[model samples]
Target chain A: MRDRIIEIIGTHGKNQGALIPVLKAVQRMNPRQYIPQEASQLVARIMGLRESEVYEVVSFYGEFSETPRAEHVIKICDSTVCRVNHHRELVDILEHTLGIRVGEASRDGKFFLEYSPCFGACDVAPALRIDDKVYGNLDRDKLEAILEAYRR
Target chain B: MKKNVALITENFHHYIPPDLAGYKHFGGFTALKKALALSEEDLIERIEDSGLRGRGGAAYPTGKKMRQSKAYQDDIKYLICNADEGEPGTFKDRDLLEQDPFGVLEGMVITAYAVGATHGILYLREEYAHLLELLQGAMAAMRREGLLGQGILGTALDFDMTIFSGAGAYICGEGTSLIESMEGRPGRPRNKPPYTKAQGLYLKPTLVSNVETFSAITAIVKHPQGVFTGYGTQKSPGTKLISLCGNVNNPGTYEVPFGLTLEEIITELGHGVAGDKGIKFVQVGGISGPLLPRACLKMPLTYEDFDAEGLSIGSGAVLVVDEDTDILDFLDAVAAFFKHESCGKCTPCREGNRQLMNILKRMREGTALPSDPENIQRIAHTMKYASFCGLGKTAPTALLSAIKYCPEEIFMRRGQ
Candidate 1:
């Protein structure tokens, strides 16, 4: 993870304008990992700065998570396209079953739910993400049935 | 779309012809010829007489802006075409730029002529990098055809336009902030009174019109009586270009006459909600317009209609929500956006929007105490009234409107 962060940051680090995208690439070094404490430290070290300095950039952005997500990550798309389709039923079922709400990992630590805006898929209304996978045209029963397998 | 027909989209309003041939077909730029024959004052009066309002959220009349812009005594005045449409759900301007670049260019050129501008600047959003190339192409074509630069269309209007891209700051959509950004300042907004029309870009009097507002000028200029007579009520005349996204059958931009009801527009043009979906809420006008509950969906999409509903039409950005979405989560995400976008220039927005996210995040996590909902309302209400700039002032409008109509939906379990 440390070497990968250096490589990504080192490759495009000279361009100040590339900061946002570079930081994003560094953040995604561990795809399944959420916000790790050392991630900021590593970012600071890679960028030749203090840990608190890198932490500022991480905390500033809404997309960067501070911790690792659950085994199954579910982001319901509330973007312009998805809103037209309606994902409330699926969100509700996930909330009820996982015993967690949006932007959170379940108490059992198996699933995470978050809201995302505009995934550029207005054609298929009501979109969702499981781990990194996107699903569309969801119904509540199917959402629960899909989640049952992720639980184990 | 009409027994009274309308064409407002790339799908519908496509292949618009240009030049004398195209102009005659669509009745183009006749207003310019007439206005040129008359005086600038007469041109301004023609527009004010038509009762055309600004499409960029302020609802200020366009003719008034032109008159005020004309009042400035700068040797070099400017017409800044605000294509940096940073609003989240709004794409009406994008469509206008894509489908009818000439019409949009003509509006800016004529507007510059009226305002006595020699140079024009289009502050386009960086995301639409392709549009930068498109607009430049159009300008090059205009210049080659002698429609741009000195003595345009054989008139004294010597106007040339250049395009500039914004570096990912949403607050730059505010006219003042846009000027500041162009002057190479950080995109944080400034207080008004030294309004943009009076002392804008580089301390010269400037006129900033939304891309959609500029496009509407062509239609108005084409037919003087058509401007006043054809569409909308007397107060708010002319058609609106709506950016319709989400679960509609035809999810695209539609240019329709004003005063159409939400139900009428959604049902006829939006093709109604898919499946058995009943709309839970509609966030009218991008991020700032009120979050209209399902009940108000029947209201007309006019200025008066939203005014009656205690909402504003904002900039024709309609985000449709169906029965099953989580309102709390939606608020959380919105609050988070405002918080993230806060330029840190003022406390009401900087601190206020940040706190909004906290309360929302808490509510989402079930850590919010009993009085949390009330506190949430209090902060939002304060932000609405007290904030310094448009960013802080309208920051909480979506949340506030959401809470007003869907009082329980803001809190989980409470709404249930």
Candidate 2:
């Protein structure tokens, strides 16, 4: 797994500009979908960036998770547009169904729910992104069915 | 009456993005070909005469920017499309990238030609990672059609672009910070003396404009200045793409001419506020923009009018609020957003946003200080005058404007 991760990082090249892209590539390689401390150290050593610098890149961006993440990450839009369009209700539904509040992973490691400010998809208000795919104009049943697919 | 200029949003509402064939069919690269025929000076003059301004909220005249870059003598010049659409409510750029990728590329092509830039970079936000493949495909198609590679369209000029996805940072949308991030550092806004136009992107002359600005450039280059300037008002001579959201019935990207009144925008294009509720206020631009109460609805949505009213048409993101909404809650969200997104390089912005967020949190819990509002204004004033960049300077706008216009909601509010 480490070899494969390093191989993926190599594909991004060893330039300072490759730091963000390399980190993203490493995280995607991890099944837990996060840049583990060891991975960060490896990236730091290989890319000639300090460990502290690598960690700074990791923590500065909201997308980079320090700890292990669940199989699927669900990001609920928390901007004013989503808020006015009952985004709170969507949060409540996800929390109730997944048994975890915002920013927490479900106990079984099925989902991680977090509030993202805006996905730039306010055209269809009340949106959420489960992994890479964005599902907009969400209702309770639609949300339930979408989660069910990921669960299975 | 609402007038629409469909240049930026030509391929919207379509199932698939406009591929090279589709883009060519709709007169896509006509601008680049036409621009190639004209001398570089004339090309820049056309843009200057067209009265196109930066659509990335600053509204600086595009012609002046191109001419400035052209004046600089450098072996290597750069043109960057600021597609890092991280503004809280602004999604018009996203629409441009998703729908008409080639139009934006063509704009950058013309810009590079006029500025004598050989390299271009599209600084896209990482959250829109899905669009990377789509853009790469478009670029590949352009290469195959001889539109993007060396000596594009059989000319001596050489220019091409590659996408640089920004790691998640709202401050990166700022041009200096974006250039810093591109150079492989934490995204922090640099102090201005050597402004980006003069010394930018590895200490060379660079031209950075928003995605929508580039799309408008494509249109201006394709047609005559009279044709491009025919739609909008005299001063603000071009249509603006507004990302209308929040308490609006028709919430989507709408392109309207500059003279449209805010009331007409909310009613005619927006289809009025959602649920037929009375409007409490509307926020023009994004989170960092001025908030106007219902009384100012008749104000024309122009840079001049908004500027007179102590507002800006920054990013053209109009977020409407209804009567039932609590202004305090909105302020809390705005404060929190600035707090989270502040680059923390300068003390005034970093500490000021943290302090503002803390006070708003206290207000949410009914434990705020009596002097909290005054403190917020003071911090806001200090940050406005002292902070390093636009992020800190404009961070306090929503709260300060709320205090000025809708004090009844913010001041009298109690427990959650």
Candidate 3:
């Protein structure tokens, strides 16, 4: 992981401007999907940025997680369009199925549910992103099918 | 009889094959080739004459912005296509990028030439990481064709572009904050005075424009025969692409002339509200935009008309709410979005939005006091005037506009 962090930092030139990309690359270095303390320290050393400064970038953006996450992440759209299109209903259904709230991960470490503000997929309202793939115009059956596939 | 001018969205209905040849076959890059022949000053002047404003809500004149960067004598100036289309309800840019990547690229290359910029960046939102592979492949094709590399199209003008994905920060849509994020920092707005055109990116002169605005430039430059100005009103000429969403029947990207009324946009373009629901109010812009009551339905969509009514054509996001929708619930969602996206940089935005969110939550739970609306208005006033940037300044727009238009609807008694 340490050597990989160095290589990622090198891939993006070792400069103050390269800090965000380096942190993003390092976070994707593991299934945990977080910038570990050691990785933050390594990024700080390579980019000549303060360790706290590195942590600031990670915490500021909602995408950068600080800890281990579930295997498959499900981000339900919570923006105005989706909300009016009954996103809350979807949230309720997901909670009922996964036995977790909007911000919680299932006990089995299989899925994480979150309220994402506008993924720019407003054309297809009531959208949700399972990992990186966005499924729009979602109904209960479609949501179940998607989760079922992910679960398998 | 005005028609939906298909300059930016002409080939939208068809699947755009992700290559330069595919784009060229659909009348793409033709404007760029013509633009390359014109001198930089002439190119800037032509766009200035067209009255094309920044499509990223502010509506600042595009040519004037490019001219500011052109005035600066920097050897390594930058051009950025602001594809960080995170504004809720504004999916027009995303559609433009997906449907016509070459049109946007052509706009960027031409804008870079006019502004004397050698390098460019497309600051795309992280959620649209799916489009990165297509954009990367398109750029490679452009490079091979010598259109993106040194001496593009056999001219001394040299320009190239790269993509930088923003990691979920709505505040990054603001120009300076976008630049700060590109520098690998937390996307926070900087105090203005040294505007980005003079000192931006790596403290170099830069030309940053919205994706739709760049796409518009391609259309504007392509038609030297005044076809661009033929559509829309005099003050606000050209077709404005609207991301028509919410309870509307045809909820999709629709390009309409600027002077079309809210009624026409909703009824004609959007095919009316879904399920035949009675229209209540419309949020013309994104979350930060003012809420227009049904009384203003006849109002024109021009910037002049919207500005006259103390509103903006912010990213052209038209969200129509039906009569069945609850105003308080909508406001609660809006408040939550602002609170969540607040960068917490300033006291007015951070503390003010938190207070606003708590009040809305209390109201939703039927535990609010009668004086809370007044309190929300007070906080909104401070955030509008005293807050740091556009996000803070415009955060209270919907709440205040709702109060102004439908006071009885929003500030209701508990359990009525």
Report the number of the highest-DockQ candidate: 3
Q: Report lDDT per candidate.
A: 0.71, 0.86, 0.87
Instruction: Kindly indicate the candidate among 1 and 3 with the higher TM-score.
Output: 3
Candidate 3 lDDT over B314-392, as tens digits, reads 9999999999888878988888898999988999999888998888778778787778878998999999999999898
TM per candidate: 0.75, 0.97, 0.97
Candidate 2 stretches with Cα past 4 Å from truth are: B11-15, B414-416
Candidate 1, which segments miss by more than 4 Å at Cα? Answer: A1-152, B1-31, B412-416
Q: Ranking by TM-score, best first?
A: 3, 2, 1
Ranking under DockQ, best-scoring first? 3, 2, 1
Give every prediction's interface RMSD: 6.0, 1.1, 0.9
Model 2 scores a TM of: 0.97
- Chain A TM-score of model 1 comes to 0.71
User: lDDT (0-100) at residue A94 of candidate 2?
Assistant: 95
The CAPRI classification for model 1 reads as incorrect
Task: Please give the range of 10 consecutive residues that has the lowest summed lDDT in model 2 chain B.
Answer: B10-19
Per-candidate DockQ values are 0.11, 0.72, 0.84
